[model samples]
Target: MFITSENATPVFKDLTLVMPAVAVGNVGQLAVDLLISTFNLPRVGYLHTDCLIPMAGNNPYATGKDDAGELHTAAEVYTAPELKLAVLQIRAPVVKSKSRRFRQLLLSWIKASGFSRTLVLSSSHAYQRDDQQLQGTPLRYLVTPSLLKTSGDAFKELGWREMEKRAPLCPERLDTGAEEERLYVPGGGITKGLYMDSCTEDVPLAVLLVFCSEGDNVPDAMALVSHLDDWLHLLDNPNREGKWKIPTSWNLLFGSGIPPAIF
Candidate 1:
């Protein structure tokens, strides 16, 4: 259920919704954090559901101790009305058994809200790339037919790479020769399933993803968001990396310094 922070539900019709996939390195989540901080978007509502683990904390985007005490939940929606953009920042991982339910919940909300399009920021394991994946840019994308109908020439103009489908290895059927290729995005939690589901549901959705590993992914987040800006034009001259603001919550991303006593 979506509960508004204000008394009235905000109108989201035709707004671009950007969300993250809890995948490898948490890159998508990190990128979303950047988007929220950069835009200084305000909290619109909460996507409260049991499909994700319950977690709560002080404001992750707080600038000081005074403002840090505000309560923030596992999943929240932020909005920048001027830009006609809405962002869903999910801080918790999905409950493995309820993954499908979570996806359904999201689709239902998107439909109800009447969003023009939805874009997911996600990442896959770079090391798992097949021979075909290793030859080009680490960034890739996937678009549902509904999005393609309206997004004609946009992706093509950007020179974006579509995620490659890999043929499964089946030695037993080597004589027959397997011709079917499958979308395999290892470490991309719910990304593949959600994308396929959106296709079937006729949802206008796009996924912008990167091939990355599980380690300091700040750079990966920056790169992903920058690419997204190219199409969305979230800010004037947003192509510059230095222009993006880093959130105060990211200060201790790796935790505190080592204790001198250990020496």
Candidate 2:
């Protein structure tokens, strides 16, 4: 269930919710880290459920040494009240059997909270891309029908490319028109599921993702965030190439130091 902090303030209505799908290269999560750290958004609450593997760690967005050790849960919510933005950062993968339950819970909370819209950052395996998909930029976007009317112009202005629906895998299914073109997100964990759910529910949802392989994906994350900034104007700078501050938590991403024995 979704739970708020004891001192959490009421600020859910009409907010734009952003989250990341744990996909190939973890580009989405890293982009979220950049956003939370750069904006210094506060941790407002967390979602407690059996659907996800339980996890806890030091606050990744801690501003200084005093709060460096603050405990953070697997899925935490942070917000920027002024911008009407809320970000849900999930650090752990969902339990395979409970994936559906988790999606239901998330969608229910979003509906109950009355968010204006939702955006998901995700990534897919680069090797799976078609020849046409590999021709240009690796970034692509998808928007539910409910959100198309509102953000369509902005997307066009930014010269963004919408993800193309792929043909079915089975050759026989194509003859009967039983195979409609559908968004296929290979390696995108819960992204396709969540998006399909949103489409069915008529929720205003948009997905921004990149195609990448498994490796150091900090650059891919940066590019994804930069693409978002271009459309949303999330940062203060007018220049599209403005630099974002990296979070302090990244210092320990690979671990704090070498083991004493090894040293």
Candidate 3:
């Protein structure tokens, strides 16, 4: 459920939503962080749902002491009205049993809010990639049919490779010659399910994901957000390099000083 700040409801009609899928290396989340920090979009509401693991902290994007003490929860909503953009940043993993419920909740709100389109940023395990997936760029995309009808031309011009469908491993099913191929996004938490649901429900949605390992995924996040900018043109970097400000909270990524005595 969306609870607006100070009990003030904001209109999201026709806004384009970009959300993160809590998956491998949290690349999607990190990329959303970059977008939020870069744009300095103001927080509008909170997604108070049981679908995610609960967590809280001081404002991660706080620009100074004045805003530094603001309380932040696991899931929050930010919007840049001028850009017609809204972003949902998920800072925690989903509860294992409620994955389906979570997707339904999101779709219900999105449809109710009247977003023009939705984009999910996510990542999958690099090691799971088949031979064809290993070559070229690690980026992949999937668009629901509803989005295809409207954004079809834009996709064609982008020259992007669509996510591949692979046959299942079960021999019995294979022997039956089931002609259907499945969209498998291993390590992409709720990404495949959400896309499938959107397709079934006739929602205009697109997913952009990267293949990456679990180490420090800052670079992977960089690449993913760069691809996003290619489509949305959200950032104003003229040189196509530098200028993205890293958030203040990331300074302590690996925890504390490690006690100088231990060193």
Candidate 4:
């Protein structure tokens, strides 16, 4: 099941961006909304979408008819000339039957608008653990920091927000803070990791920053958004060591237009 809705657009300086909540989770939309709201940037567009699928291994939505009768909703388009950035949210349940169709729709919009690069905000678990391997080994978190960098008239700030916060969640230790620790477990213990079940603002910011900067150096990109996440993870935890290879400076190339200050 997939769904979409609309939110009001904003106004940011000369740059008006369209933020879309494509799937259920609106992290992408939330990130852009925060950026625009915080910086008072222009917003050209806002769209929201969602999805639903049979998870009990049986299509209860299906009647006595087509078992393959999956819900593939229609695609939507948000257009604007001043559109500098677009945020897309992909959730657990998309109209698999319409995945290709929706992808085509999104691609068509990007191509028609002459966007340099599409800043894809992919969910962390989607890359590491699909439906087939949901309860398998813990995923190794990684990212291409190279696709992030920007400065000058318009800049990109990249990073993830602390989605899961420490709260009085457990009833067993309602009054005892000693027994309750800030654990990163989303679903029991299998899906445990800093970003295993959560999406970060950094994902979108990194991609957008890169596209905005015309592919600048990765370190410079890291410098922009790296601090956004800060040191949320502590040592001795599985998150203390992720397999994401931080791109070296040699692996990145800066455009001549990039400021010397960034170097």
What is the TM-score of each predicted model, taking all chains together?
A: 0.95, 0.92, 0.94, 0.30
Candidate 2 lDDT tens digits, 1-263:
77888575557899999999988998999999998988878888888998989898887877789998999999989998887899999999999998888888999998998999999999999999987798799999999999998988888888989898887777565766746776799999999999999999999999999999998889999999988888778886453245688998888766788789986
As for candidate 3, its clashing pairs are: none
Clashing pairs in 1: none
Residue 98, candidate 1: C-alpha displacement in angstroms: 0.4
For candidate 3, the 10 contiguous residues with the lowest summed lDDT are: 236-245
Looking at model 4, residue 55 earns an lDDT score of 32
Model 2 worst lDDT window (10 residues) = 236-245
Which ranges of candidate 3 are over 4 A from the true structure?
Answer: 237-242
Best by lDDT: 1
lDDT for each residue of candidate 4 in 44-64, tens digit (9 for 90 to 100): 332233322323222212333
lDDT of all predictions, in order shown?
0.93, 0.89, 0.92, 0.30
Question: Clashes per prediction?
Answer: 0, 0, 0, 23
Candidate 4: C-alpha lDDT: 0.30
Ranking by lDDT: 1, 3, 2, 4
Q: Given candidate 2, what's the lDDT at residue 69?
A: 92
* Ordered list by TM-score, greatest first: 1, 3, 2, 4
**What are the runs in model 4 whose C-alpha is more than 4 Å off?**
1-26, 43-94, 126-263
Q: Is candidate 1 or candidate 4 better by TM-score?
A: 1
Tens digits of per-residue lDDT, candidate 1, 173-229, equal: 666457778799999999999999999999999999999998899999999999999
Candidate 2 root-mean-square deviation in Å: 2.4
Candidate 3 TM-score versus the reference? 0.94
